[model samples]
Target: MKIAIYTLGCKVNQYETQAMEQELSRRGHEIVSFSGAADAYVVNTCSVTAVSDQKSRQMLSRARREHPGAVVAVCGCYPQTRPEDVRKLDVDLIAGTGDRMGFLDLLEQELEDRRPMEAVDRVFDRRAFEILPAGGLEGRTRAMLKVEDGCVNFCSYCIIPYARGPVRSLPPEEAAARAKELAAAGYQEMVLTGIEISSWGGDLKTGQSLIDLMELLSDAAPGLRLRLGSLEPRTIDGDFCRRAAKLPNLCPQFHLSMQSGCDETLKRMNRKYDTARYFRSVALLKEYFDRPAVTTDMIVGFPGETEEEFAQSLDFIRRCGFARMHIFPYSIRPGTPAAELAQIPAAVKESRAARAAAVADEMRKEYLEGCVGQVYPVLFEQAKGDRFSGHAPNYTEVLVPGSENLHNRVLATRITGTEGFSLLGELEETP
Candidate 1:
């Protein structure tokens, strides 16, 4: 059988799609591009926002229209939360956000029986972590290893808690094993991803945490660089930084989730931490790591966000001196508490987003300029034009003129200049 996968949303969704593809290939099926016709088309959907939901539906509609006879399967957050809405699209196989292996089996069964199959279960009822394969199809230098699942932080604007259920962790030994497997598979780096990786070990009685899992995996695969997915700001205290800094393989790029920088806006958003605690996390990372790339996400226009609050957020972000930031104008997601609250006009949201984006651009340029004249080890991934582009230990994209064979190999490069968000460099001679 030939299979095609169309993935939408975050790194976790991408990781799951890759795992499913690998599983199908292991079962004697050939994987093809989503644009190409196939025996089955898997649409791993996302419903993070109203916009994300619309995009998911658009992809599903296009997939069915393009490949009329192929078995269409939908899974992930969207179907997990609103299975009935997905069923209306007339997909052949529908499974929610659990038991991916079982979902594959059910997909095959539906194809065999030539009948529609709905395998979605109440997402809140899921308690066990579903272990999927790690790594990607291409021989890329980086891969993702999902060590945890689900989230307990029911932020007012998020539906992920309902769609993904409570925190369920992959045991430390299993996480270590998976990291080793990825290393053996020739992956040079692995990103530890999950819905809420900071909440890892909440369900465990052994008192293990994300730091424990990182320690285990760092030892399990010493050759592989370990990167983390979006992390809760509360997870980066002095203790966590001290232990993580000891791991030679851990990447220094930390993306702390800060939806809003203003304390008042954060309170309205129901975020767990205040601006002070979030700034402390940023300070601790810089204190422990050598010029680590501290990145963050910010929501520009929350409900009842006054001009004063917006200005406070802008100033707060500028004060943090973030290397990069993802700025979003608040989109009213239906079924979320924030959606029913006082709404901001589209023009106001757009203006705030634009203002935040300008500040983000300035910060990015400043960070890139700081990289100039520094020699860093870059893991080259691919060649483009007269240069081979890759990333440094801080996850900053570096482009340097090098041989095609440099792909998948780490090379020391002296930063020459900066072009927007990317760094231009040249290969440095060995000592």
Candidate 2:
């Protein structure tokens, strides 16, 4: 069987797609490009916003229309949250947020029987964490280990909590074992990713937290560079910063999720923390790490967001000095609380996003300028022409002129200058 997966949404989705690809390949299936025809086409969808849903729908429709004979399977958040919406489409199999292996089983069975099947279970009823393989089918530079699944933070703008259910965490021992396996497999770096990583230990009866899990993973894979996924502001404090600072292999970049900076806007969004607490998290990271790259995501022109509120958000983000930012205009997601509220006009949302993006660009330039004259151990991933590109511990892309294929090599690189968003660097000779 030939299978091609089209994935949407977050890093977790990407990891799951890769795991599915590996499993399918292991079971005597050929992985092909989504553009070309195949025996099975898996459209892993996302419903983060209404726009994401449209894309998912379009892809599914295209898959069915182009390859009339191929099996089209739809999975992920879009169908998980709205199975009724997906049932209206021309899909053969529908699986939700959980159970990838079972989903594949159904796919194989469908191929033989030619029956339409739906395997989306009650996501909230799930208790055990579905452990998938950590690394990708092809590369060794970086791999993602999903240590946790689900989110209980029912933010007004988010549909993930309902889509992914409550917190279900991978045990510390299991996570450590996976990290060790990735290290043994010659992976240069391991990314600990999830829907909400900060809520990792909530479901487990053990009195532990994300920092504790980080310590365990660091110990298990002492040679692998461990990177973290997006974290909640409440996860960072004095103790966490201090403990995390001591982990030599842990990357110094932190992506704290901050949707809006205005307190009123945060209240409307039902965020866990206010601006004061979020800023404290930023300050703590800056205090403990040496020029740590702090990145974040922000949504502009949220429902009922006044111009003053937007101004406050811009000012607050400027103060935080984020290394980079992902800015998006507010998009109404049906079934979420915010969708029923008075919506902002599309023009207003787009204009506010542009304003926020300008500020973010300035901050990014400032961060890149600060990187000049610093030395960092960069993990090279890819090469183009005479330059090899890699990322520093702070997650900053560093490009150096080199003839050698530095793929998967961590070399000492000294920043010489800034080239747009990336830093231009020269490789240091090892003695």
Candidate 3:
């Protein structure tokens, strides 16, 4: 069987698609390009914003139209959140966010029986973390290991809490074993990713925190560089910083979720922390790690956000000095609480997004320039022309002219300059 997977939004979805691809390939299936012909088409979807939902619908519809007889399988956050929308589509198999192995079984069953099937369950009732196969089919240098699942935050603007259910975490032993396997498989880095990683250990009876899991992973795979996904600001404390700082294999990049910088806006958005608390997390990372890259996400023109509040947010983000930022103009999801509030005009939202993007672009350039003359251990992943490009411990892209076979090797690189969005550097000769 030939399978084509079309994934949309977030690293967790990508990780899930990769896991499914691996399992399907192991079962004697040929994975083909999404644009090419295939007997099965899997559309892993997202529902973070209105735009994502639209894209999900478009992809599902296109898959069905392109291959009239192919099995159209829809999965992920979109179907988990709004199965009714998916039911209207011409899909053969529908699986929600959880239960990847079960989804595969259903897919194979449908192939054998040629029956339309739906396996989506009530995501809110899920208690245990559904562990999937780790490592990606494409990359040898880096792999995303989903250690946590579900979010309970329930922010006013977010529908993910309902889509993903309560916090469920992979046990420390399981995470450690996966990391060791990835390291043994020649992966240089493994990212600890999930829906809400900071909320890890909340549903567990063991009372161990994310810090404990990090410690275990570092110990189990001493040779692999462990990296974190997006984190809640309040999760970082003095103890976590101290312990995480001691882990030599951990990357020094922190991505704190700062949706809105204005306190009033944060209150409206139901965020757990204020600007002061978020700044503290930023300060702690800088204090503990050596020149760590701090990145974040922000939503502009949220519900009931005033011009003054937006200005304050712009000012606040400049103060935080983020190395990179994902700036989103707020979009209304029909079921979310924020969608019912007084909405901002589309023109205003887009204008604010542009302004915020300009500020973020400058900060990104400054951060890249700051990398000049610094020496870093870059794990090369791909090549462009005669040069191989990879990422440093801080997750900054560093490109250097080298042999083509730099894949999966950690070479010392000294930063020289910047070209376009990438940092240009050269390989360091070690005596």
Candidate 4:
């Protein structure tokens, strides 16, 4: 069978898609491009926001139109929360956030019998973690290993907790083994991703934290560059930074989640940390790692966010000087606590987002300026025209003129200039 997978949402979704693709390949199925016709089309969906849900439906409709007779299987957070919504779209197979291996089996059986199947379980009742393969079939430069699942944070604006259930973790030994396997598979970099990596060891009583897992993975795959996904600001501390900085393979880039910089807005959003603690985390990371790229996500214009509050947020972000930021206008997601609050006007939200984005753009330019003339070790991933593009250890994109075979090799490149969001560099002679 020829299978095509359309992934939506976060890094965890991407990791799961890779694992499903690997499973299908091992079962004698051929993976094909989503643009082409296939025997089966899997739409791995997301419900992070209303826009994400709309996009997932759009992909499903396109798949159905493109492959009239093919089986359309839908899975992930969207279906986990609203299985009936996905079933209404005429999909043949519908599964939720849990039991991905079982989902694949049901999909295969439906393909053989030419029948429909719906196997969504109660997300809150889920207890065991679904372990999937960690790498992609393509000789990709970076792979993602999901060591944890689910979230208990229950942030007022987030619907992930309801869709993903309670926390579950992959045992430390299993995570270390997957890291070794990914490295042996020729992936130059690995990103440890999850719904909430900070809650990694809470399910187990082994006294292991994310820092402990980092040490194990560093020893398991000493040659591979290891990067982390978005982290809660509350997880960063002197102890966490001290242990993590000693791992030679760990990337210097850290993305601390900061939905709002103002204490009042953070309180409304039910964030765990205040501005002072968040700033402390940022300061500690910079003090430990030389010029490490610290980035974050921000939501502008929450309900009842006054001009003074917004200004405070803008001022705080300027002080932090993030290398990059994902600025989002507040979206009202139904069933969340924020949706029940006094809604902010769309025009106000748009204006605040624009202002925040401008400030972020200025800070990004300054951060890139600081990287000028510095030589970095970059792993080339692809070639375009006369240049091969790759990413540095800090996850900054770098483009340089080189041969195609430089795909997975790390090379020393001297920063020359800037090209949009990427850095332009010249390849230095190998020692």
Candidate 5:
């Protein structure tokens, strides 16, 4: 069977799509492109926000339009959460966030029977992490080993907890094995990705934590660089900071999730942490890692979020001095609690988003300027012209003008200056 996958949203979704691709290949199936004719087209959907749902629908529709005769299989967060909406679409197979292997089987059945199949079940009944293949088979420098699944946070604005169910973790031993497999495949970097990585060991029950798993994986792949996915602010503590910083190969870039910076807004959103706590996490990252890239996300114009609250959020984020930021204007999702709360005006949301973006841009520029004259072991992934570009240990994009194509090679590059948002420099001889 020839399969083509179209994936949207988080790194976890991308990881899942790759895992499915691996499974198909193992069963003697060919992976093709969605734009080309194929036996089946898999739409790995996302439902993080309202926009994500729309994009998922658009992609599903496009797949059907492109290959009307091909089997259209839809899975992931969107179909998992809104199966009725997906049922209205021209799809042959429907499965939810869980059971990738089962979803593949259903797709195979549909291929043979020439009939539609829906294998989705209640997401909350899900238990145990469905471990799948790690590393990229498509020749990528970085591969994500999803160590965690599901979210229990139940933040008022989030529907993911309901869509994904309770927390499930991959055992430390298994995670280590997966990391070693990825490293053996010549991958230079591995991202510890998941739905909510900070909550990794919450469901494990054993006397282990995310730090313990990190220690094991780092030990397993001593030569491979390790990067982390988005983490909850409450996850960062003195112990986590000290232990994680000790790993030499672990990248110092930390993306602490900060939906809203104001304490009042956080309370309304039912977030687990406050602005003070969030700032402490930021301070800890700054203290432990030598100039680590501390990035964050912010939602503007949340339901009932006053102008004063938005200002407070902006002020708080500016004080944190994030290296980069994702600024989003809050949008109402039908099933979320925030959707039923007092709504903010769309124009107001747009205005606040723009203001937050400006502040974020300044912080980004300041952080990049700080990188000037610093030498970093940059894993150059690709090149355009004579410049080989890659990310620094802190996730700073560094472009070095070199004659050689430094693909997959970690080169010592000194940051000469900034070129727009990226650092421009030349390759330096090894000391």
Candidate 6:
């Protein structure tokens, strides 16, 4: 059988999709592009926002419509939260947010029997972390290890808590074992991803935390560059940063989740930390690491967010001076508490996003300029004509003009200039 998988949303979803692809390939099934012909189509969906939900639906619909004879499977947050909505789309197989192996079983069963299958369980009832294969398919430069799953922090604007369930962490030994395997598999980098990685050990009753997991993986896979996924602001402190800073292979890029920077806005969003606390996390990362890339995500024009609050957020973000930022116009997710509040007008939301983006772009340019003339060991991933591109330890994209196949090779490159958002570099030994 030939399977086509289309992934949407966060790195966790991508990791799960890759696990599915790997499993299917091992079962002697051919893995093909989602756009091309295939025996089945898997749509790994995301429901982080209204737009994400719409995209999930569109992709599922397209899979069914385009490949009418092929089996269509839908999984991930979309079906986990809104199974009925997914059922309405008439996909052949439906599995939600758990049991990757079982989901594959359902996919195979559907193909064999031509019977529809639905495997969505109540997400909140899930307690165990589903362990799937960690690495991607052949030739991938980087692999993500999902060391945690689910979220406990029920932010007013988030449906993920309901879609994903409570915090369930992959045991440290399992995660370390997988990290070692990835390193042995020739992956130069391994990303630790989850729904909320900072909340990793909450359910385990063990005193170990994310920093412990990082240290374990750092030791287990000493050769692999370990990077983290989006982290909670509360996760960073003197202890966390101090320990993380000592891990020589840990990438300096820290993507702390900051939906809104204003205290009142954060309060309404039910965020655990305020602007003051979040800033401390940023400050600690910068203080502990050398020019560490402090990145964040901001939601502009959240429900009931006033112009003053938006401006405050803008000002606060500027104060943080993030290396890179993902700015979003808040969209009402129907099941979330924020959806019941007074919604911001779409135009206003978009306008605020544009304004925030302008500020973020300026900060990005400043950060890129700071990278010039520095030497960084870049893990080159791909080549395009005379150029090979990869990323520095801070996750900054660095491109070097080279005819050699630098793919999967870490080379110390000297940054010569900035190319817009990316850095232009030359091999340190190049003439």
Pairs of residues clashing in candidate 4: none
Instruction: Give the poorly placed runs of model 2, Cα more than 4 Å off.
Output: none
User: Which one wins on TM-score?
Assistant: 2
Q: Please provide, for model 6 over 8-125, each residue's C-alpha lDDT reduced to its tens digit, 9 standing for 90 to 100.
A: 9988888888888888888999999999999999999999888999999999889888989999999999999888788888688988988999989888899999898889887778
Weakest 10 consecutive residues of candidate 6 by summed lDDT: 422-431
Which stretches of model 1 miss by more than 4 angstroms? 429-431
lDDT by residue for model 4 over 1-431, one digit each (tens)? 99999999998999899899999899999999999979999999999998989999999999999789999989999998877788789799989888888998999998999888888888889888888989876878898899999999999999999889999999999999999898888989889899999899889888888899999999999989999999998789999999999999999999999989899999999999999999999999999898999999999989989999999999999999999999999998877999999988999999999999999999998888788799999999888887888899888899887565578989999999997778999888562
TM-score of 4: 0.97
lDDT of 4: 0.91
The TM-scores, one per candidate, come to: 0.98, 0.99, 0.98, 0.97, 0.98, 0.98
Better of 2 and 6 by TM-score: 2
| Top candidate, metric lDDT | 2
**Where does model 5 exceed 4 Å of error?**
none
Q: How does residue 137 of candidate 4 score in lDDT?
A: 67
Q: After superposition on all CA atoms, how large is the RMSD of candidate 6?
A: 1.3
Residues 223-267, model 1: lDDT tens digits: 999999999999999999999999998999999999988898898
Writing each residue's lDDT as its tens digit, candidate 3 over 285-369 gives 8888888999999999898999999999999999988999999999898799999999999999999999999999999999899
Clashing pairs in 1: none
- In order, the Cα lDDT scores of the candidates are 0.90, 0.94, 0.91, 0.91, 0.90, 0.91
lDDT of 1 at 212: 88
